[model samples]
Target: MTIRLIRGAAVAAAMVSGVAACSAPSGGSGGGESAYSVVIGVASEPDTLSPLLGYGKDGNSKIFDGLLARDADLKLRPALAKALPEVGDDGLTYTYTLRDGVEFSDGRPLTASDVVFTYETVLDEKTNNTARSELDAIKAVRADGDDKVAFTLKYPYAPFAGRTVLPIVPEHVAGDQDPNTGSFNTKPIGTGPYVLSAWSRGEKLTFKANPRYWGGAPKVKTVTMAIIEDDDVRATRLRSGDLDGAILPPNLAATYKNDSDESDSGKKTYVAKSYDFRAVTLPTENEVTGDRAIRQALDVAVDRQAMADKILDGAGRPAYGPLPIDDPWFTKDTERGQDLDKAKQILDRAGWKTGVDGVRAKDGQRATFVLRYPSGDKVREDHALAYASDAKKAGIDVKAESATWEVIEPRMKDDAVLAGGGSTGDPDFGLYTLLNSSLAGDGFNNMGRYDNPAVDKALDTGRRNQDEATRRAAYDMVQRELVKDPGYTFLTHIDHVYVLADRWRGLTTQLEPHEHGFASGPGWNIEDWQPKQ
Candidate 1:
């Protein structure tokens, strides 16, 4: 929220690390004039550090930046670009004039060519970025000059300008290598405020301030992120003073409430409102989950408010769909509440009769399926368990299990996975890849293999239409269809909670995306941070 204009950041995934040594006071990272550093604990790490492969696709990439960036209010602002883009009246074209003197970490100038290359490569058929569909509206991208880039879209995509937040990669550095397996995947060059210092894979990632950053060098000399996927482990590290800060669940974060009384020795807490949500995939391939009766019944049966109040410790809200209840795009008609009786009626009419064990059965298939969550994620695990409890009341057996993403990926074909996704900007940013039929089972997009022709068409119309009313109607149809045939049982929308060692003056939180604080929370403007006087 307190973005330093001498501006310039995302989180990539990594293995857990012991960074207790980084708990040093201000001069640990740099000496003399640059005597400021901070370390934080994050849950996941990026598979590849390259933007071409989808790292930092949501902006605040830290090491890289998009042509444009968002303010603390989530409004579009100039980053690599000199100003916002000018769109044609038809809404098919967007053109931006690049900021002069913006140089990559390698001291090379950033131009329109780099912007064009970044988009072109990601849109290439051979590239492995699953987020390509997010850019499906782009018909062509052209460099007008050294500082100007123009994009022509197939339709008047209303959210096209916001999509420019896709981080730009140095064409000279990344364009020469294979985007999928290039050396640059681990080592990248960008025009952001920080440059990668060392990547200890499963341990920690270290970064140094870019002295030649266009906005002027950041005051915070170095930043380190310690990957700690387990909630208790992260909380313990923060408690032991082994970390400067960390994102923690509401229950764990509340334990530190008494410590804030003595401000000098304790940390401050922040509650960042977000669109991030937790939902269960009801895969279309599973006999039990694929049934309309099971899907519909489970959708209405789950006590969304119970999960929000009990599991989240009142830090979040019940998620009716991907959008938060307060989101402008949310359809009020799609809101559902606990109705166990109605759920039983839906199942009974569908012939899913209760058998000898109190579990429903239709034909020869039993009403049961395994619910998977990423191992060590307590928030997701709690959500899965709560969902299972709700399913039990309706005569369905939801066996919840925990596993790493490696084990959960293949099983996603038929098994339900506790998943998280949502974005701060346009509805298309959060919905298209999640519900589009063409993207079913492609990496994480549409993991349930949901196929409703009406939803699919509405998604397209919502994405392509220029009229606001038309887009709203299209999205309303999409949400209504999901309620009619729920593909995923949305549990709750999370408001990310973080406890921080308050040693700096500029610390603040932003309206975050699905990535939470890892890429776009309080540290979204880390470059502007200054050591307390």
Candidate 2:
């Protein structure tokens, strides 16, 4: 069956009239500089365009510039800000100086008021901000001057600077609107390289390069992101020359690598080891996964090496823990090898006896739980199937189920979820939200309800302390403790895949976060691109 591609006639009309019709060739077969528009075929679509809600998660950073952005090396770099914030009072306070002459896409000048409003709205109880917990430490945010802003924290939050990567919304437009259901989400106006030209929900969204952009207009005048949820379809579109670039799975991406006929195209597949790992979220409240022995047994029972080799097609590495092995905070002792005999012993000691059907039973409760993964995701599905097969060796009945995020979320507390996580430049980004006791029961944080006083203390040390050595030591302790009773069973760190048309040049990449290619993908610096001469 063929998927329908909705025609973006309105966006095309806008381009032809004036805005993006400047000086490029119009034909597609042989493109001129003006005809150098890119259509990206992606696996998922952004839930909203509102920065306050969830647009930032899936590489929508092109439409908005944060106070700070990460460099190629993932180091904090100034975007809207003139430089990094200055800390005082042992990190309790931070002062920022904004870059002069920055303006939103609507031509509204950016000021300290916009900065203050963005933070206040996030902290506001009335607004449903997904990132509310990330900014909870802020006691107050106020403008010191027209071009400056300052923040006072209730306590010294070590990851405060890193969290500043959040996109800054315009106060003039979003100040009075209900942040939860604002029109700005569908039609956003931000201080970024591109402007939202048109949005055809569930189909495609078109962007026009901002002529007045602070960093200057991007090279590709128009960009269209076609939402193709299926992995096979995204790869198919890339091969058919309908898509300029696409994020593909390892197996699909391998098909395009080193293609002699498609020499005009390119493919990149790399293991961004810094902060990409897939794992299963075993809810502690669930009866089947409540026992620490079950959690530990499942961790070792799953052959991580095989998953990395087979599922990822040798494009990834076995992940022993949340932090990648190369990460400075990673501890080697916590990494355990797959041992089926050991897994069975752990279940036996916990009074879980094998039943007639080969499933384990203990105290009238059977070792069975529905393992859910997002439907249409091939990678997550494969991991879920592999996990279920391995768990059977230890008499555990892990029923693999596929459903949308909407369905899986409500049932998360009662079932195991095959979730994708681990991002942000700091360890606190992953550890704090995933394991924090205070964030339990909330959909965004600690969904598994895996609360441990020892784990909490170690995470706090990393968040409360400012010194690098102290923070490093705290994270090391956290890895060591978690290995004993890991909250999530880490599977493998898969390498992100991308196939791009060779018509464009200057496509560089960095160590990507969990979600590939949006914020830090091959076209991240598309503004600096130059058509092949």
lDDT of each: 0.82, 0.75
Error of 2 at 527 (Å): 1.8
- Which stretch of 10 consecutive residues in model 2 shows the poorest summed lDDT? 1-10
Write the residue-wise lDDT of candidate 1 on 263-363 in tens digits.
Answer: 42457888899888888989999988889899999998999999989899999999989889898989997888999999999999999999999999989
User: What TM-score would each prediction reach against the true structure?
Assistant: 0.94, 0.91
- lDDT string for model 2 (287-306, tens) is 98888989989988999999
